[model samples]
Target: MKLILVVVLTTAIAAIGITLSLILSQRQAARDRALSIISGNKLQDATGKPSDKNDPNKRRAALARKLKESEQEEKDDKKKKEKGKSTMRELIQQAGFDFPVSYYYILSIVSAAAFTIGAFSLGFPRIVIAMISIIGFFGFPRLVLFLLTKRRQKKFLEDFADALEAMMRLLKAGMPMNEAVKMCAKEFEGPIGEEMSRIYELQKIGTPLGEAAVLVAKRMPIPEMRMFATGLLIQQQTGSSLSDILGNLAKVIRSRFQLKRKVKALSAEAKSSAGIIAAMPPLVALGLNTFNPGYIDIIFETRSGHIGLACFGLWMFTGMVIMWKMSNFKV
Candidate 1:
């Protein structure tokens, strides 16, 4: 009877605690909602205020000024949207693989399926089959995608200087900034042009220029594009000459590109030496295995062999990372 009473008491205490927790959570949620509503109202009040006037001539002048400001604001907005659209397109292209998260899930499923099949078909050890599946389905695909994305981005950066020069020439010819961008989109081929074309279209369809530029900057993941977008946004806000600003930007970009090339050239020998040194160990191990099978088999035929292999892989990876860091230069 006493034990039953204790159990009942425990259950009641837990239920009370749970109920209190739920009540507190509900109160917190309500408070958050109220705060959100208050903030939203403040934003609407600031952005949606109405213009007021008392006299006819004054009203006319006020209306004209308001209209002009609205038009300029609209143009700025269109440019921003165009920039955004272009950026998203560039990111997709440069990454070389769409839907990385989805790809990982797919690869996981594929690896599991391959592992199951290998275990059943060849009578391989479960661990070996698992390793094979992991390497073939997940590891190899990830490696390939990484390499491809890197190469694609490199190509885009290499081409960026020329594209900027072309746009600068068009700007010098007294073409409007938007028109010059469109001309570049039409003239250049590849990722840069493709991104520019998207921006051009977005600007044409009434997207805000500032918003478009922000979008483009976000998508490209390039420092130069980000810098350009920021400069353009500031210029638009301050009513600066777009052509002269872009010309100076073009010069800066060109100089940076040249500097990057020089850095790469200077580091090429060190990079090459690192690669050769990294390869030597593996090649020497292979030669030893080929020349003396029994001697090599002793190390690789036991659990200790697996441990050694894992250690070797770790060492190699660490070395490669260090070498890459040494070689990499930012401008």
Candidate 2:
């Protein structure tokens, strides 16, 4: 029994270690690529880009003023609901999934059943099995949903600047803003395309371009998307050069992306150290359990030992959260 338990624990640890290593390596590679790009090229000027406006400076200044007013409006609008949590339906929509809310409940039920079966097979106490079932039902599925939503948002941001540039091109070709958005809907793939298509549909049904943009921004709730929406609103109100505004917005988004990459690269050492520190307790416990199983059996057999283990786990989780919040920079 000890041998089997040791093997399972080792396998789980190895799997986690391998996954973390792969994630770190990927981030390093991306950082190197971003640094190379940053070193090789300069950020393009907004005014240097192709523009139909004869007086670029005047239009730029006018757009800047309009943006300031729009920013204030946005702040006012967000203040009322800044702390509100999204509903499950909103989360599903943000993740770009078409599934109904009932699907989530079904998944939770399945997960709970699986977890309960596993705990029973392992001969855990009834109370312990119930707790695990509750976690599987309420915690695991919700966590997965949040992760999916975040990943979708990240993918959307990756393609968003390109989408904006494409829109600029279409706009410069003398297409109206709504028509350019419609063209982008067909041109791009994935999240950007789906969002653009939604915007186009909204516009087709008589929603104003600015209103359609706002809907997309509200759905995404990312800074880049919000900026795009704000620019559209400003353009609609002031008749500013939409192409130039989009061009500049794309540049800004790219710059922010590069900065985020640089920050991630710089923080790699700290992240590595944190990972090592976090693994130490588990590794040590595993070693002790392997060589002297009696010493660790108390943790599994006694009520006090169980409480101690629970407290240790709670503290470890708290520490991990604190470290994550500290290391996480919102770029």
lDDT winner among the candidates? 2
lDDT of 1 at 137: 70
RMSD of each: 16.1, 10.1
- State residue 42's C-alpha deviation in candidate 2, in Å: 20
Most TM-score-accurate candidate: 2
* Ten-residue region with minimum lDDT total, candidate 1: 37-46
lDDT of 2 at 239: 58
Per-residue C-alpha lDDT of model 1 across residues 112-195, encoded as one tens digit per residue: 687668676988887888787767776765565567666766777777777777777887788777898898888877777877
- Per-candidate TM equals 0.61, 0.72
Query: How would you encode candidate 2's per-residue C-alpha lDDT over 143-182 as one tens digit per residue?
Result: 8888988888888888888998998998898998888888
